[model samples]
Target: MKTNRYLPLVGGLLLSLGSQAQTKLATGSQKPMPAAEWIDADTGHKIVRLTALDGANESFYFHNNPFVKSLGAAGDKMVYYHSSPAGKQLYALNLKTHQSEALTRPFARVHGEIVGKKRREVFYQVGDTVYATHIDSKKTRRVFVFPADFKADITTLNADESQLGGAWGSDAEKEIYRQYPAKSDFFNRIYEAKLPRTLFMVSADGNGQLTKLFTDNAWLNHVQFSPTDPRCLMFCHEGPWEKVDRIWTLDTKTKAVKLVHKRTMDREIAGHEWFGADGKTIWFDHQKPRGQTFAVTGANLQTGQEKSYAHTRDEWSVHYTSSADQKTFAGDGGYPTSVAKSAEGHWIYLFTPEGDHFRSEKLANLKTHDYKLEPNVHFSPDGKWLIFRANFEGQAQVYAVEIAKAAI
Candidate 1:
């Protein structure tokens, strides 16, 4: 292992603040509203909005992840990153009490993940190092550190919270963009160079032991773990939606790697892939002929069976996620790629995997913008709430809708 000489300089900085616990309650006039009377057209479940914050603070849910691992029901709290005048800080919102508390001191662009089903420990990265803090005790420990010149992208914690995985590299694509900056052909230029990127796993118990599971000369991104299967995890070769072979999975026990929904032809774009609630299947949004649209697609990791659950004749329903039971699927009609057309309107839809799939109903009318990131709708572990981010009140804010307070 290569030693970072600067680690000693920051050792004191980490030790000084490691044991300190800081917290503040959610303030201001904005408060979460009760369930709206609007009945979901398919399930007939009442929709309830769960958050209303006044300022620009927002949650960090990604488009490709189906579950908000950070927002699991420990203490009924949801963790999010807030950009204050001081810096970016992590905050936990207690759903029952409707209070937001500070979890860490303000730093540069801080985001977090919650681990363990019952214990609920949190993980987040600052610079090239990852840290863990228990939700109840607030005990902090340094989990892992990356080598010099390499940055961590898309940090993920495994199902049982035994390991943490991330994509690390020189971030050459971002640096190259500064040199050859172009609006349309920027990614095309970056792909011309085989940038060094690696998939790394480390002990989640703050052992600081790092293992490089896979390395590539391409842009590897979105490292995600299976929710049920302990040994299974997935990643992507990220670039223009159409250019790369999108999804790949790795088994930690066997060190086996396989492509989930492999593209056999050109213009077959498959990106924004995630695992289902069962952890047996991987789900993704795919578009053939590149610029057309996307449909809901999935591949069973155990059986290797692939199927399409939903597709569009007119426009694409780009991002796809599912309920915890895997019985329900949700999608937003907005595609974030430059090649795909601008979204027609801000709408999210829901569908059943088994019957009446065509009867996908509009769940919410989102306030969205062009050329900006779209809200990735995710379900809670219990499948009762749909969590998403939107710019409804001018700035992006995290919001959740209770789909079924009790099972219908």
Candidate 2:
């Protein structure tokens, strides 16, 4: 195979054969091998026990966006949101029993992180009402609602609200910062309420003891909390009069404000990646004038020194995840499309182009400096099975290969 470093710009064509072939397994007969499990990088044990809930008949007909939004592994459950004709609905899939149930009824959208263990809490918006549902109990309670003309930007919330950096006592249970439509002159005012236009925090029990955090005439958008500390909140303050957007961090304890990063007239700074586990390092994509994209870098709380990882024209982003013992770093790598790890990390997943098809390789023991494997590799959580997601015909599916003996 030729080792060309550039990412292929070819049109979207599903390549079959080679590692993309679907194979049947013995243990999980009802589920296809490719869809059955995902190898855990840490222990090499198959972590995600997947089963096709719907849309399995048309071969290619599977979950369009069936990505797992939140995995409730501690509670032996998982929650995912799927787009439907009515709208997007949240579904709870029990991992142990392989049973599925719908948590939210049709109407409104469930934005932000879905919280909970066995019984999870889903923060969703309908019309003006913001509600939370306990998946196990099937109990739905109205948390808050938007005011008449107010709109909430759901994208502002972090993956699990774990990175909300503000001076709040605990993570805001049901808090949303809102803005009015573009045309409304009254859109600039900040309020603490359910929805419409409000920025307030609620108790876990749906009690609205709203406390006004800050009120500024400037249009505040994209409110995010620091991944390391909930008290440090960062938001973008934009106004019609201003030319460029400014990012600000608010110290909840001191109520002091600091300007972290600002953009000049010609360049705009966007894509804020707050390293949740490591508070200091923030990674973002920066577009250069030469038609090349560079991964902009920042420091975490501990390091307090800004640094950039190795540059690759293939395009790369940092995945903020510590190893099993938090001693090593691991993240997804692009360009060649693979997962990378720090020096001490054991497992590395890579994809190498083999003519028209691609092969997945698993490299172990970086310390020895000698590690290699065949393509289409998947590492189980316990390092027992290797599962691979492949595309066949016009359809994409998964396949698994036993790696328990191979790992030894």
Candidate 3:
């Protein structure tokens, strides 16, 4: 692994101080809210708005769990999926009015399979049928169907869904869809239907038959299609007997697979690592057994090379976002970090530790290359805003940061 220079900045500076104030309680007693929301700078609108509906309740009730999913900008509007005691729903938050209306059909919840592309079209599941809905025309059509016995469980579906490829083909032509088993226990045996352990492809129209791209029975923990080449994919392969895990590359057309990285028995790759925007590199966390220290490695897929950004025993996590052009990258490398890249690829929103509150930073240097932060930070679909839920300022409340200089 290649080592880079270490330029340390001062520990704390309150970079976002006074730009925004914490929301106070109804009694003016300053009871900090348990969750917060933010808007993306590039889209010039709030992509997320959430709050604590169930006060201090942590029992496993689905309604009490507050989380955001399927946040993106489609056409002239911002869209997202949310769940509550009422049920699962999809909404289009009008950028002009700041109003949200349920787009999900009544009695037919928006299954976790929903995904939005660059156009106004959204792919989602209702019952056993996968449907695509156009936000502009309010038209919906069936895109695919599962086997008769297959059931739709939104929660499990959320866990199993993978964005294997980009929206490449036109609506009339070929489109790539990635499917995974909703249940982890299903990994023990191959489905009689010839489905793969994790990575499988089918026609967007659901006409062509399902094809298993990778034969390895090992569970494919994560799979990503190369943004540059839609026919190429990168995925992580693991099994019970293996001492370590490695990432591999596969060409769908040639039906060829190659081991891009070999595993060392003493260390394991972290599951949540992601590919760089360039599609030629992958970023992952490497953990050392019996040691508290961890390091982040960026591996070049073509050259079989790696570079380490940071190594520490501080229990830190890294969040990364790269420009659309793949020329610039911005991320926060630390514990409990949050980062969002602008869609135009010019700026990044970074939040770091500051006692009870998170100090926010809008950075323009895409070549800084090495840093670390805490995990679970999210970016808006337009890549202009960063949003997260945290217990800062005595309680969790939503906050937004503007990346004014990020338009590429």
Candidate 4:
């Protein structure tokens, strides 16, 4: 069947211009693997479980690059996490065939899903040691290990795949984590403590050369390298979203730091910042004053020109993502207990930017999904579907909801 590419746009416009209801999943809806795919009852769209793995499968964090998108004739592969009885490991799913290739064995505390698409490899950390594995060959190599004074998690890989960027938590921040362990226990306390944190990068050539970029007396985190500019890096001041000036850019060559978005209103905030596909824009989940309103806002990295697309409270998502071409956007909606305290926000949304606001069309109903494990959303490499991880099927597994309305 030929899909109408323009059909979804039409559906989005009608819903945005007229009336719409909060889409909800069927009671105890279960579209587990082996079934492969199912039609979302509320939205009439095809939703597919990416891989039929038997363990708890999960996708990458919202901003981290997971897909080795431009693989030419070989097609793209998405690297994700899996934990079974054998061991917790990393696997690359063949988007074309739905087959998975194991990339790593069981390792302790593997951090970040930083894919060096250029090198055709995935980079991660086991404590202070950084490792890179070949996507196609399953061959692994030691990238580099951070020194004692600069040990930190690997966050981003530079455009040319030369440098891996990250932030080192301060002793106070580490102590808070050590004592509290869980994010819920330490998140607030560390932020309020205003502990010192350092931003750094290490060479992928395995020389173990640590480049300590800079330090600040605030929680520095979410470090990302510009996808287009190897010398340019982006990070955030990790704290309570409402209280922090979150988005920032750093010039690796010059050691210059600039604040990306300055809050205009009293309680205005911008966080969860990520670089556009071209690396020319920095986009984030924006709100005028805390949980009152929501929008996905973007600021031109060079010109500082801002563009925002607003949505209703219930349309708000824990994380939002832009397609590879930057032409479309999608979000994995929030739950009732989310900070927005949404009454009905259980839909996986497909958003079309209609000037100042988004023309949103519900793609999948996620009413039964757990909110604790955030459904970090990403657009498929071909922009045909929105990929996200959900626990709605009783375990954390990655799924994709077709952007166009369809039945499988």
Identify the leading candidate in terms of lDDT.
4
TM-score preference between candidates 1 and 3, better one? 1
Q: Where's the lowest-lDDT run of ten residues in candidate 3?
A: 56-65
Point out where model 4 deviates above 4 Å.
Answer: 1-28, 31-34, 69-73, 106-109
Q: For model 1, name the residue pairs that clash.
A: none
TM-score against native, each model: 0.78, 0.51, 0.57, 0.90
Q: What lDDT is reached at residue 115 by model 2? A: 45
Clashes per model (N, Cα, C within 3 A): 0, 37, 20, 0
Question: What C-alpha lDDT do the candidate models reach, one value each?
Answer: 0.61, 0.37, 0.40, 0.79
* Winner on TM-score (2 vs 4): 4
> Relative to the unseen true structure, what is the C-alpha lDDT of residue 33 in candidate 2, on a scale of 0 to 100?
32
lDDT of 1 by residue, 1-408 (tens): 111111111110110122111111111112232121233333343333333443455555553332223343333556665565677776666544445666676346666554455446668778767877666566777777766765664367787778888777666677887887874566676666778888878888767677778888987877888877778879898887667887999888777888887786788888788888778888787777676654667788878888876455333554667776777887655744434555443456666765423446655555333216466677654565666666544555665544532233
**TM-score for candidate 2:** 0.51
Give the C-alpha miss distance for residue 18 in model 2, angstroms: 17
Q: Which tens-of-lDDT digit does each residue in 282-334 have in candidate 4?
A: 98999999999899999998899999999999999988888877778888899
The residue-by-residue lDDT of candidate 2 on 1-408, one tens digit each, is 111121211111112232222322222323333433333333343222232423211111111111132344422444544444555566654433445567775456555443433224655566556676776677888765544443342222233342211122111212222234333433332322212223334334455433445655444554655544656656655432123345566665576766654444355443334443345544433333222434344444444454443333432322222222222222222322222222333233333333322243432212211122111222323323333332221122233333332221
Ranking by TM-score: 4, 1, 3, 2
Candidate number that wins on TM-score, 3 or 4: 4
Give per-residue lDDT, candidate 3, residue 295: 48
